[model samples]
Target: MIQPHQHADQACSECTQRLGLIESGLRGVTPVRFNAAGWYRGELRREILRLRLNQDVSVLKAITFALQRTLPAKALLVPIPSWKTQKRANPLPALICRSLGRTTKTLLKRCRPTVGQHHLSRRQRLVNMKSAFAIHPDQQSWCVSATPTWIVDDILTSGATAQEALHTLKRAGLEVRGLICLGRTP
Candidate 1:
């Protein structure tokens, strides 16, 4: 339903159950719109896909507007690295970061290419994403703080990607507070 605002707690367990995550909670007010039918139905999926693949910002304004309003005031936003190795010419996390810079900023970068998770099992997804991210050298300072970060991604499925990202950040001494996504796989 995308609530206009949601509060950030010190932490939450629901995400732990759903994503096997530690050191993070789910973002506020945003709902999973990817389904057979509903608010984020057909056209929305196509638009999101378009934006993800082509960097089309034409349809993401509403999501960005909601994100700007709902993001926690105290934390920075760490976008989960995009999958495209060629260059993130377009992708959801990149697009969101462009609009979310005020309440949050990015500190992680994909250090390597990852195998796509589309056809993988949970175990495979976890293995595939292991060590897939690295904190930027210049952003190393951001990793030093116990200050929480909201790990943003385009979707939540098995959560392997977010879990891996969280672990990578933790490995670098960064603290992750939550997972923010545009949708949840249905």
Candidate 2:
């Protein structure tokens, strides 16, 4: 089963909680090895950010293994799309979902582009992601099934993106269990 990182601090938990992203009563999972500042300076940050630029099989395998242990077996994984409008602009989330050996669905699409959240404050990130995602036109009918779904992402920072994904899916009448990410920023 997935265990919380021993190094996770109260501040990190508080930060996520204060963002009010998990208020839907769904669990949020992340292995917090370091705070956001430290994570940004580390090699894992480079590896994760470069996933869109390069598809590293070894890194993808390692991340998939780590997340798979924690995710519920019955949850259907729905990847949060990147800011780009192109179909597969960023494959990290979907790749991770596929690697997890679970039922994966691409049910959300970016309705509009938004600034990257890496440099934004929590408020800015939330504002930038506002109405950024919508249910894919082709997937509208898929929402009729009340499957336990999870939003998959490379990292969970301010959670603006995940929150918006959750909002979009719920609005479309899907049962979103919560978010599962490779890492969480303190």
Worst 10 residues of 2 by lDDT: 32-41
Task: Please provide, for model 1 over 59-79, each residue's C-alpha lDDT reduced to its tens digit, 9 standing for 90 to 100.
Answer: 344445445555556766777
Q: Which stretches of candidate 1 lie over 4 Å from their true place?
A: 1-41, 88-90
Question: Could you estimate the TM-score for every candidate?
Answer: 0.68, 0.72
- What pairs collide in candidate 2? none
The backbone clash count of each candidate, in order, is 1, 0
Best by lDDT: 2
Report lDDT per candidate.
0.58, 0.65
Displacement of the residue 59 alpha carbon in candidate 1, Å: 3.0
Candidate 2, superposed: residue stretches over 4 Å from native: 1-41, 85-88
Error of 2 at 182 (Å): 1.4
